[model samples]
Target: MSRLTDLIAQAKERDLELGRELEREFKVLSARRSFGLNFERHRPENVELPGRPLRKGDKVRVLPPRGSTTKGDQRLWKVLRIESENGMRLARLELIGVADPESASVAVDDLVVVAEFRDYIYPGLVSTGKVERGGDKPFHTVINGENFYALEALTYTHRGRIDAIYIDPPYNSGASDWKYNNNYVGEDDLYRHSKWLAFMERRLLVARQLLKPSGALIVTIDEHEVRRLGLLLEQTLEGFTIQQVTIVINPKGVTQGYLSRVEEYAFFCFGPECKIYPGDDDLLTSKDSTTSDDGYSRPRWKGLLRSGDEAERKDREQMFYPIWINPKTKRILKAGKYLPLGEEPDFNVKDEEGNVAVWPVRKDLTLGRWGIGVYTFNDLVKKGYVSLGAYDKKRKSWGLSYLSEQLRKEIDEGTLVVLGRDPNTGVADVVYEGAATRKVRTVWHRTSHDAGAYGTDLVGKLLGNGRAFPFPKSLYAVEDALRIIIRGKPDAVVLDFFSGSGTTAHAVMRLNRQDGGRRQSICVTNNEVRSSEQYALKAENLRPGDEEWERHGICEYITKPRIAAAITGRTPDDQVIDGDYKFTDTFPIADGFEENAEFFTLTYETPVSVSHNRAFARIAPLLWMRAGSKGRRIETLPDEGWEVVDTYGLLVNLDKSAAFCQAVGSNGTIGIVYIVTDDDRRFQSVVRHLPDAVEPVRLYESYLNNFRFSMGR
Candidate 1:
């Protein structure tokens, strides 16, 4: 050990960089086993763009011929020229950055254009189309692109503004559902675990910056990666509080060796200001448990008379008060102030309606204190939070009850229904239509959460194809998960990067319908074609970017159509959808939600294009999102000097600053002012003169600097 230390010290003195490397290697060699996460962090993941055609001077990669091998060459080739020979199209290619470069000729169809993760690409969006319900409701956006790049772009527009994020990333259970470095990782793959961690870590780091201070992030996974994912979240989201909940998605269970797996896990990471809200059900009862006679679960009221330790009136003088009740109706009218310790009680006091006074007394006839103080009881009486209990034969007086804080909140949020006045109490007779709410439990078992019956089957019905996509989340499950954190925020902004089949967006729409909320969801997914579909398309000589092949991509094939069907209450074939949404709220599917949605494909642009103001058409939607995504978007440069719309304003000509400011001030609803100019001094001067409420942004320059800083352009 002494000799080893001496050698290490000498190596460090000789060369600091090499010494650190040697020390690291020594630690690995001497350890019993490596711990924590370890992987090739810099290994670039490559994706092929079949939509981009091969052209001379464009970089390309040679793809293996069909039925050859699963492994393909990772080497990148540069296209030198394109030529036709013997009725065949061929391209000359050169290996880039080689000292003695080698050149070869390959058929155009044999190569695919690649986007390497190591290089930075300017990102933009192109609107494909939209579904409008004709209202001022914010549009739920679905972007088709690699999630990492989409998240990077969102950081500029939605940073620190999202209220909640729910994602269902691939489980990496040695299935074909997930990919690493553009290849599916089989069960036998040696580094699959490490690759999964690295892939998740990169995206999560960027996602962490998109949350508001009060926002929460919910990630659902199966047993295959739950433990590893939990550890990764701990390291990545250091200060946030993390909790895990187990949900039974398959009650029958799938057999695995000794035990049958029936449940998955959802990890909830709550920010400092985040909290779990109440659900319709107590979330604790067994699926088969019986409810009340009305098919509802009602709150069990507690007596208002103090009992047990410190129950005497002398214990708390302030709690010793008289509750006036109408003798005829048994209705609680008001609460009288507390009696002094030396004062004698008056049981004969009556209100103008011949109401009698009631004192808190024990069964033994000893004086007791009220459960709540006089002021609290008085306020609760007005809000119907107080209740009257049945007559007690032993005490010869009617008892009183009150609601807990959790139950009161349920009444306020409309989760509990109020059925006029109770004949006995005259207070609002509120009852929960399902199970009474309680603190969210760690274990959840509901028939609606079953993946097969609700998830796979429901999605099949919507898409009209049983296998359009696999393993979509149960609609009710997603809604319940989101409701726990965002129940109070009616106009929240929710995002899901791994938006499979657009489940998160559909769930958000359902939530909005349930409560009349205007919450908007931003879903991002890739347009990668399924492996089986790719093989079939390739057999027909169809490439990825071809119209027919592109239509089969996940976004176009499943997500877009599913969302449209859900919003329009009709299937892609123009027939009304069958069935109804169950659990929490039930309504016919044909009565589609009154909502608006838009689809966009992520596009790449040159920084030069954005800086020269040539890409305003592409960048306009993003600005609308940044300005709260309300009203109509300014899609083109105004022919007039300036333009002011519902939520934002734009000044195309600096000569119209005064008019623009006047219009902005007069409108009073605009919150963002985009001034198009390259001059910093002039922009600052105008900003100071504008209204104090609006935020000023320098166009082109501000847009260029954002990506340049984040993407290192």
Candidate 2:
């Protein structure tokens, strides 16, 4: 074996040994698990609190039996121990700070986790009453809530339908950029990496279930956690092709300590059969200034000599040949015979002055092959597809160039093309067809992707003078990344769980406006109050959880307002800021998008128990979202809370089941109806009255099966 191959094998063996040693050490520490990473940490299950089995140390407010205690007699107690008696869990409690008080036993149901009842409520949407011009278009959604729970709610509606997901998650740079459970996790925290990993793992697992089999997930991160996030994604999303692309967001790098970091990473994890769609932005094209007699620039020239792998005569011996040419005019005359290795052929071509001309060969007389074989070269030459360049004294030979007939014809036809011009000579060096496009490279350094100009300045202009978000991504960069994946699939559904400033939604709307496609975006972000906002709110004695503080969060005050401004062609202050959009250069800045979007804040459903009868009302918005959030639900008596989508109606109230079915039967397009009734017999009876083309489905049954959770007794 070659020395390099041997060295690689030895390195591989050493790596295997190191891996085994690490495995053995982990096994010795009892950290090895069967299927996944084992951190050897205890994490309690997130359950509905205040009922069923209660753990020790839980606080309780005790009330006397019906007639024994007055309204003012109740006192708070703390659970000391929990034990099972007669198949019932009981808690031993002691009154707080009561001197010499005897401990009392009570049923586990009497005790509740502190402030846990408020969590039992389901999340609901509070519309901000702001929608843009296109009321008839599919509504792009910006959900204001904790993404974990928001994603859980979306599972009920958008499962397996999302076409692409682009998320710019926190880099965990220890800069107080992100918060976990309402508290910022700093760099010095012991479980910082673990917490971030766990947080992303949970969300990514859910996000995976939401992607179509042909969809892709694009995630952006910095060097701080790129490797960790990559491993986490590989472990969580197995059997997928994952590629990491380096994007130069900052050309002038940000200096940390020694090195200036200019690049971040994007991890693209795609399902089988998913391929990136090349965009026209980076395509090679001709310039307008370089016009020839035919109104098009001269065709570009390519070196006829092959250089890499197969350039040597031994690789493809038949490609080694000569072409007879006039020395002065630099025009091809005829083909010459091919010479085998260690053989030489004399070229005795004479110019008009009778001077013997030399063939185009390397200075050292090495036999290099042409780019194509003899027959291909002959065909190209016959079709005027070859160009002979001026002789070079230093190289001791003339340079042969090749041109395709299609390119020549395009040049003659005056097609708009991209031409590379020389600064000194003012000569067009090469020309390319305008229609030609190329795949985007891993490294993107386009000026349009500048975060400072496009992200901060543009967003600042839209939201007001002050910076609305810190280090927001460039809209054009996000749009370009998305366009690469969803170009042909224009009607695709996009999702961004960590939609910081709702840039993804804006890009989607802009894309739809550009292509007249009906693409929709679902953006989920928590209305977490930033530190700056918190300080401002503190001046007014308003803290988190206060109505005023909640209204001024990142989602409500920034994300939603920015989206509204982009759609309405005005700034947040109502000033018209309309013009040509700088990014994409295809749409007007203030064109007032012919698209529509809704702003919603997630709130919880009251009364913890979501019963079958009330389930429809609780999940009606979810059904509307599933139906593409097109038209509003009909809430009158004859309709009585029915959501219609084309010919399909989601029957929420079946009070007048027969009348609803009869009305649906009159409409020939109403082929399918989802009736929300718990009774199977009633559902079957309702189906009996439906039209022949219409099919009946039980909405409540499916809802219950999809969203079954533990409710404390």
Candidate 3:
């Protein structure tokens, strides 16, 4: 068994054993009446308040006490107990499940219940510019906010639609690359790995829900967290086929203590039907090729004689055949059918020297077969698809060659012509015509995949400024990975939660342009400033929330600007950098690319006491986005625009229910109709009047349940 499988089996066995032991211990304690020995510690306490009473199992937000050392680390906490201390109510709080070091206690007022893990409503996407080559609507999106909330919002619009996900999350390298709860996590942090795992686990849980059945998730990481991340993915994404691919991002290794690290890893977790598209064959250019035409070199040749087990006649007796050729002209004449053992086929033609031609059989006379069938060989010869190699005079044989249909077409069209003929066999050496495609390998070593060369330098040129984001991924590398997953799926939706520098989205756009596809991308990234940048800003007397500090953050200055520059072929300052990139050149960065993008910031609706009664207005945008964001919105009730329901149908006024239904039935082509009413009678009344074409769905109840936080008021 593989090491990972063996480890999983061992872990299961250990858990089973541990469970049995715990059960036996519990029985012994029950028989000896010792289960109740810790009765004082298990005593329950009741604390009453003016509003909703505090209870166990409720999720709450814990605010640090006035003079505590760990102040301002307000995080989601669970209420463990509620007791009275010195006539004042004190609630015990724990961080999710971890016990507080000092048995943290907070006043009843400070123990606020979490109303919502994230906002039920999100802001509309504001279009910055258009990337013209894409479809009428923008095919790419960038959300500048916390990824967790962004992913949650995506679940409403893109669930079960995204075909691939590529993310380069923080490696947790203890180099201040990431932060937890607004504080940078460093080497000395005790729960660094645990925190990272928890963060990934929650986001991945939501991310998994957003994938189609034939979708894949690709995550890039360094050595510091590869194994742990792999294990975490295995545990969380159960039943997924997980694979690890080693990527050589940095050729010149980064020096550490003893070893210089050069390689990182990409973890691919896919569903059952997920198939990778083998990229074009031009990627497999041989080292000896001289000139490349249109980003591809000449097609390399392979031997026609079949090798390995399949070469034996027993594997397929029909494939065992002979190919005939003219002795002087070296042109293929005919291919002979299958012959039994010890049987020789007759040839009609003879050599110019009056020598009878020989069949292409092994000297040992073993029953070996040709790579293709006899009929296939005949068809290839008829189309001049065969080439000849140097003659083996001692063995009285000549090497046979087969050309692909692409090569044959190229030769026929005169685009690829016969340069010369072989001196010995008189076979023509033809120039290759079109670019061929081949399957991508697991290990990538192309110069275009280099991080520093393509990512840093190319982005620097596009931005027309020297301020480069730290360790951005190579755009070509991301494109190649995505191309493999989204090869045949042109209209597939792609998502990236950790969309640093917006490379994934940029790659998606490039791939769409190359293939004339309409694939879309949704990128989610936070606006937090990097630790290095933050320190430098602080040294310059700029604080975290200051306008200057916020303006230079990763999401604001880096990711958005980079994507804008890439699409428009210009820097943020409108300086043109849209032409071909001179650094390690290939394709034009801005040619044929549309400058289309929508910038959105996730925010909570005002007056955040979001109960079922007042959630309709807050969740309208969420429902609109869920309906593909394809229609116009009807702001006021009884408006003339209500005559047309473009994408989504919403009804808030019960008095105009009949008119709304009549308008929808007459002129609307909506997919779903959301009816808002506190009374079931009114809901059913509206539903009964709606047409059968539109799906009638009741809002508020499910919305409240979905968005309500498990916290005390």
Candidate 4:
């Protein structure tokens, strides 16, 4: 265990029943980051509001309110007033526009206040996923392979508590690859790009609320949408700086090369101090590690090291200066000392004329004599520093490389550089080859590292499906990038929202296994759409059992089952790969969108009630299920997007009550419930929250707003 891990060990191992859930939330809050959140943190910072109270050193979102309007959502002010009634002020207000202003006070309802703190809490092991409402154990579900809209559905369910996220959304393409709410975004549709942007924007907006102050976000993108992605990021994410990484994936060039395509950009937009698990600059990079032919590591420098002054003297006080030395190695002294580097002998001098008797004296010190400082060569060797092993009269250049190698060998053989050194690594470039050279420059390797084949094989096995999704990410490539970011930080939460074939999840697990680190991953995939267009090439007609199996295949069990296998360390039933993961298919609650504690308390509709389908699981409570159960369920995540089922008011968001409304039927039963109200049309369908109807509810309004505005009707 590392020092950081050791410090956090008790916290990680702590049991979270309820208060503990709130407690561990700080850690989660510290961990989770969203894309726009990073940019917001980095961009010109402004004093803003967080959903909660501000603490010192907290990163707050600032909104300048000098020329603000009365028709905007002043949510922070309202929440503060509600908080202030209890005689406490959490938000610090600033009135920048009111011409040398003091706190601008207009309406108690609309005074824009700046809140500084942000934190997210959850109930259990359940990350961002679709949650069910009633009873226990999932009864039935909507099996989506992609589940693209599930997170949107969940925003209402698990509202107000997401910290960080990474998404790889579809770039608009017509090859049956990308989808918008289950519909393909073919190239022919002019609004395809717009639709995709809207879909992403809604998710980003809601994602903002889910982040803590110190959180960040990462989104993956390709060339197709890079142009619009910039604008979309600007509009949706608000205050953040965009960072783009170009990964050279395919060096072989495209099939039809207008230009042999070799690289694709991974555009990254983030907040200040946002970091993925990459190696920090403070740590030495592998490029700095170099070894030489002499089996010794040495610093690589450019230009040349010309010899300094070479005057010799009995009392050589001028030449002695302090030099930095390695202290770690204990010297294996053999009754010897270091030698001084040999210098060029002036052919005219008596020392070179083989006259030990006529050695010249210093002109200034020795009273204007015929030569420079005078001393024998043996006098300089006793200091145990400089080396003069061999000096050729032919070549005046010193063997610098040879000397560096000799020093390295000496250090390796217990020759201390200066004072005896403690084991430490700092203040040097890395030696790449054999740890013998100098600092490595950029542009060394052309082809990037990718494990696409391994990912393809993994996907093929667990789900027992081949070519389920096209062009899934390479497992190794993802790890390579993550390894760059997540250096030395063992326990990290890796998230990938656009999980086409579970490559990100697989890489995290593989890296964890490789390094013996306890890293975890959260991969989200929408139950994608599959066309039933018959294959004209198939020979046989469908059989009786085959028809039923085909019908059953529509369920979203394939992808989730495979990912679960990877997590729990169970062999995927597929034959292509033998590796395992601990996971299960989390079916969404298909029934009961109501708020009825009564069903559990008083009423017994059936032996198994509708509420069983809707109990959203949490992450902390689901550790037991993570022990490789094939069909196990996880615990509920708090304030997540989920539906409440029952008779009373259907709580759309566990946090935002205004997002919900109720309507009662004339027959005294549930007509319908409005879980989604951010949209206008949803109001008509909402059932009144009368105690009689007992209607349950969850909504997709926040998600729908992105698309609703585009409707022609």
Candidate 5:
């Protein structure tokens, strides 16, 4: 009867009556409950600390008044979401306005985390060393979540580090598949397409950063989201070229056809220099082959070629111009038998006055560009090649192989080759048709993925506790795409913020193990569950302990755990996971950045601020090279601009990390160590790594003297 009871019934199909009775007795009776408000833009009112930067998994106090700097213990709030623009980052917090808790969809400016996750804490703690090492394969992991914000945070926080990304983001199929905060987005909803498009737009904009230039991204989307996703990738990867593709998941659509319809669509977003998987070339057995009379091998071409129009096929009798006679027709043909070139008996030659005349006969003739293959008159031919045909004594002729030699000798000796063969056999240099006309279409070709039961397993295995997330994905399907894109690339990271059941993680690990490589993957996804509209907390609840909550943390539960478990079976004691995985959700992050990415300023924007704990720290060290430096910095050093920032080096606002050495400068060459937060220790380290930076500078107390050694003020 009730929604909660219905969910219980759905979870336990056979015991529906029992579930309904249990739910009736235990279900909360409060009727005033609803999903959280999904806000598109940030509101000004419901925020307290307007400048505090929000990172992943932060629980900040909410619903406070705008100006009140609530000092005591009341400023506690949960950072439900995070967003970024060209550079400015914002935090989406659930604020309970002092006057009314209903107006809680306000956003505030985020403050940079001087210290985030300093202590490595995870529910499932696995000692990797404790687990026996069978093979040094790529560790697999899975993270599950219920919403997009959580997915974005896990993936965005560590962008460049990811190797390959695969995700089955919401289909937005005008069905319940599209849920913003908690409300179900129907498939036929008028704004379904628009809502889905907007949702994907933000995710892709951030997802692009996670890819290494050579890294590949495979997105599984239905026909509805296919076109919009194409545009989204183009907008995000500005200079990059996107190779659009159509994976016919099903020929069968809502409407039926003469044939069985089967095919789904998938898109691979990559930089200009991306590679596709070549598949198992060794497994390609050329069943069909051709050979000359003397046993020389001839090229065999397969597949349907529909070069002729309907008119040509309609008049079939016209093409039957009588077969050329062969004296050795009765002779036993070679295993790889091929017919010799026939004379030009069928072609009509135009005379001087345009009078039609029989074409001249050549013992050996080719169709040239107009026809498909060569046909030679047999009177002068030899075993497999076209010989003198009783015309010349020292003549040698094969097919293409002979043609190549003749052309080479003719070009070198400056001799005109007219002895039954012309040096310039082709009228034009270009040959063949379109570049990709050779490969067949993707109709029946099943990529080892989509066809298997893996997708079904994905849904049934993890989220089958209640309402199963339907048709998650087969690991092979995404893996096939990965193999197509990145062959044997050893150094590539993967990302997928919309991970459904961690197929991408499985693909990455499987591929690396297959190729003995070391490719990594990063996935992001939200926890999904069916709940009733009784309480706001109940509608969108995510906290510690629940398996659903852990599963929603895909990096911890799904991606990483799966990988670790495959290496070491199931965790026994710890509640982190049931499988034996020496799983620790702790990833490496220090106060300083790796300085791996080269930074450049496109506009005369405010530069990054640098501070240090040691003396002699300055802003100039980010750009210029210095001795005794292991770290490096990259920044666009502007000579002049509208507003001056740090002049010594380019200044960049701190985004993810707490502290790092950087050369900060803005237009007009004004530079200084921009202190994002007042943490002097982090600021001190920023000064110490100056030697590691491409540029090095000594910090002074002021424009005057008193320089500190690797220290900043």
Candidate 6:
């Protein structure tokens, strides 16, 4: 009937066994469904790494002369050496990846570092600045570099340790929002969708390695590519359950031809061990119904009797029970034993003090089962969990309800307000204020999630400019999404590769302030100037690494300044922000968060340049991060044999193993010790003297091995 069937039939005419094998193969291929999203995997992307000064042995690209109409050479070049002539620096360069390489002498300032995605690069981190509010808490880090490279580097230090990752990637909305292979994939490009998929696939594969077994990945996107993204995530992240939630980011919709788009999607991908935690905000209901006088929400109760199929007494024998209540006062007294099959409870039975027995009976007169068994019901009733409501005439019994375990948790956490006991039910009447905790619904609609009011406006207040960044996510929305996964884990390590304006890190700090958590955030963003600004800068003869060009880039102008202002409670010019945070906690902007953060620019390093004393400063932060990011960091190889901080220790001089061992043993707070030595036997010998609680790490080898294997394409 079909082409495949006909081909199999023709093969069968020649050889029966061959045809059978062909049929089996064809069936397996058919099971691989495409669902319309299919494309060829393109070549790896290339990005220009700016800001770092040009030096010998670095791969670079030459920029054209000022006001020149012709384009500069596009071929990759390696710097041979730098020579100063007539008070001007000249770089000797040679073309790379070609048979007959050409060499030329050019101005050192004319070159910028350029890297291909498939190239292996030994990465380094260079600290730019740091801000400390107070305390010895772990520092939140923002790395100014391409996210793909940063993610690859994180695999070495934080593989399988991150608790949650929330990324707001580009929507691929046929604009200059994103780039592929050093060029923006505009609307006119027919292969834009394929390029977007290719870019995401590479980063997601590496990101998957960073999450713990129970970690979660939350990605936000608009309607432009929601369908394709969903399919890509499913195909790439196998074995992980994926669910999407619709959030009304902009109540006033942006018109797209016939439809006014008002909502975006968040796809949460997590393993089976992960669950959507309950929160106090029930977005499905109106704000007035959920919030109370105390800013919390009222407690919700459900019927204690089971409903629907398999709810009859015969279906669950142990759940068939009766609750005794005071007929006049309507107060629940206690629960009775579960009746056996075909056994009917005496509805007329009365206990001492005129307490009447109430059986779980359906309106159709069929015997129904209680949601909980006898022992559990009795325990809950004593804790004021059970309640009696108005009599149901059809069932000939009073309506009964009880708080589930989740609601009880909310009460214990003080998110729900217990106003007073009902005179009739004799059970606590609870109401949820604004900040109650409950399981989130599929659709989310709230004032706090509004982008224009909360997201864009809040950034304006903090940064002193309303248009500092385009289309940032609402602070509350990002915070709530993170809370669902990381509320229970106070020290969660969160990573956001597509960190536009450092909102993810700001959200993490807010969460820490609310619960005194020491959670840390790692944000990666580039310092690319906006397209409109880039054209203007080019007209002025400035290049990517120029001071004027770099200052206006996203990372320098927006992400970095926004994060610092949030931590210090002062703008870049040291002026106090003039506003108060509404809803949720409601605190003044002047009252800064109690948090610490450091800024670093990603550096591409060669293997030969990473020798012990040469690269210690660049590698110190990685060790600090791996050792829980707390305590004083050793920035260089100490003159002494070893250096011991609060949380980690380092021994650069292996010859003084005796002294290093004494220092490490004396420090009770040390958890990880880095021993710099090439000999494995000598390293292990000194490790024996250290306390068993201290984990010994072999230096240079331990760090280099991570990149040696990971750097290959």
lDDT top scorer: 6
lDDT of 6 by residue, 379-465 (tens): 988878898888776776778988887777767776565778876666887776435555677799888899988788888888985
lDDT of candidate model 4 versus the reference: 0.37
Candidate 1 at 422: error in angstroms?
Answer: 11
Q: Which structure is stronger by lDDT: 4 or 6?
A: 6
Q: How many pairs in model 4 have backbone atoms within 3 A of each other, for residues 3 or more apart or on separate chains, i.e. clashes? A: 131
* Candidate 3 C-alpha lDDT tens digits along 552-670: 87878888888888877778888877557432225676552653565665544322333333434435555655655444544334243233457667776678777778777876557
Please give the distance, in angstroms, between residue 454's alpha carbon in candidate 3 and its true position after superposition.
Answer: 1.6
Tens-digit lDDT track for model 4 on 1-713? Answer: 22233334445455335445555764676577665422112111112221223332232223333233222332232222223535544444443323244432232222322421121211112232333322332211112322323343334333333234556677665565654422455788765665566556655675655444334565666677877777777776666666666665565656543667555555555554455442211122221223456554533332112223444432343232211122222211111122222432232322342321211223232311111111312221223322212222343222111124334443454421333222332222222233222322122222223323444554555555443545556555565556644435564544455666556655665555556555545455543224432221111332112333233231234445445444433334533334433211121212112110100000111112112324322211222222211123323322543323322223344344334332233324333333433444434344333344343333333323322332111
TM-score of each: 0.74, 0.65, 0.63, 0.41, 0.43, 0.75
RMSD of each: 13.0, 15.6, 14.6, 25.3, 19.4, 13.8
Predicted model with the maximum TM-score: 6
Which TM-score value belongs to model 6?
Answer: 0.75
lDDT of 2 by residue, 17-102 (tens): 76566556645656445655533221211221222234466556553332222322234567899889999988898886344565
- Put down candidate 5 lDDT per residue, 471-563, tens digits, no spaces: 656655666667766656764566666665556655665566566556655444433333331133333443223344434433443434333
Ranking by lDDT: 6, 1, 2, 3, 5, 4
Off by over 4 Å in 1: 1-39, 53-58, 63-73, 79-93, 96-100, 104-111, 286-437, 465-467, 710-713
C-alpha local distance difference test of each model: 0.82, 0.68, 0.66, 0.37, 0.38, 0.83
